[model samples]
Target: MTILLMLVQIIVLFVLVMLHVAYATYFERKIIGHMQVRLGPMQVGWHGLLQPIADGIKSFFKEDIIPEQADRPTFMAAPIICLVAMMTSLAVLPFAKGWVLADINIGLLFIFAMSSLASYGVVLAGWASNSKFSFLGGLRSMAQVISYEIAMGLSLVGVMLMSGSLNLTQIVEAQGNSILGMYLLPQCIGFFVFFISMLAETNRVPFDLPEAETELVSGYCTEYSGMRYAIFFMAEYIGMMVMAAIGTVCFLGGWNGPFAVPFFPPLWFLLKIYLFMFIFIWIRATLPRYRYDQLMDLGWKLLIPLALVNIVVTACLKAMIG
Candidate 1:
């Protein structure tokens, strides 16, 4: 029975994640469409509710293409690697009390490690494609991912310091009793750094230089098509959801609400995630893509230093309090 229950939970979580990824694409299109003064996807279903399903079906049936010179094995493995890495990060996120896939002590570090692994997929995909644009995209992805990852990891140190544990649940618990209960308030600087880094980590605009359509013709996945391309897309969206979930867990107090309003904590969590997703879409619509040089400079010069400062301040406060 215990094993059966665990299987059920895994199935449910898998379905939920996939549904979220599918709808996220639809949501992005609708939001961006409205921003540009156009009605989006009303033809598929009401407000294009069925659009994602149609897209999934179309991609599955479409011809899978490989460039003549492409390395077939690595090319196929790349998207799977990307998707799996992102999904693995979700295991440690606590949706509500007693509602996590793995309640391990090193949950935070596990997530960070898994997130870092995702870059390999981009790098491999680009290299395997044997295209100049793909190669350049892969190079950019590697540099950008590593640069932002430093800031991203450093930003979380502040949370770890205050929470006194690497466990994500403990981090959320630590926020429950303070005047500025949520880490978002006291660690505002860290939150800012992490939030910006989240955009970079997920390769969302204006940091989407890896797939900058105009310059690199879809970036690292330039040679991909059909379901292979869809896997890349799925991985991208799942990465976005993971980043949003991390933001909710680390900074916003995952499943923490004002009162135990029965059946509402998950709702709160979802709301926070959607809010971040909206910001992601909003920024994409409002900001033009950053130049490659400018993006690199911002990550290295601005975000990294800010994240370091946040860690320093947080550590000092913890020491003084102790």
Candidate 2:
């Protein structure tokens, strides 16, 4: 019975996240449209309010096409792998005071591990497609993820050290007595590194070299079509949400706000996540894509060193105060 309950919870969470994944794209389109001073998606349902639902139906009906030379088994598995890994990390993130799927002690480590695992889907999608463009996109994504992952981990080390706990909820609790309500002020450097790295992590604009439409013709997913292709995109948007959620936990003070909502307490949490999501969309609308070499330089030359320095400074301050 207990195992069945867990399975049911997992299914519920998965469906909820997938729904969010669908709506995120619709919102992105609507937001970007308004940003460019154009009406976005007015045709579907009530100014395209139900556009994502329409899209899901269309995707479900679309024919699944497999390339002649593509590795059938691997190609099919890649998107599933991506989606599973992306969702697994959400288990440990606390939504409200007691609302979380998995409140594991080593939640932070689990997230990093799941993140590393998620990259395999990208790499396999490229290699299995048997296309040079896909292969290149896979390689670029792998390299970019590896480089930024190092810096992102290092930046979070400061938070981990200060809180003395790997659990995200504990980290938030630690911030209650902090200089500010959040780690954003003291860990500004880490926050900056995290923000930039997260954009790269999600393959968003300015760092989206892996999926450049003009260059790689949709990058690693050029060969995919129908629901298989849609799954890849779903993974991408879900990834963006995961990163935003993690950012809220690490820096923005998870579920901690000036005023609490009268109804569900997680409103503060959702609001912060929404703010990050909006900033993500705002960036996509406002910024131009960065050149590949420039992207590499920004990650390795700039963000990595900054993260390291933040760690050192944080450790020294902690020692002195102790």
List the global CA lDDT of all models.
0.90, 0.90
How big is the positional error of residue 121 in model 1, measured in Å on the Cα after superposition?
0.6
**Worst-scoring 10-residue span by lDDT in model 2:** 172-181
RMSD of each: 1.1, 1.1
RMSD of 1: 1.1
| Residue pairs whose backbone atoms clash in candidate 2 | none
Task: Kindly give the number of clashing pairs for every candidate.
Answer: 0, 0
What TM-score against the true fold does each predicted structure earn?
Answer: 0.97, 0.97
| Structure candidate 1, residue pairs in collision | none
| Poorly placed runs, candidate 1 (over 4 Å) | none
TM-score of 1: 0.97
Supply candidate 2's per-residue lDDT for 196: 95
User: Model 1 lDDT vs. the true structure?
Assistant: 0.90
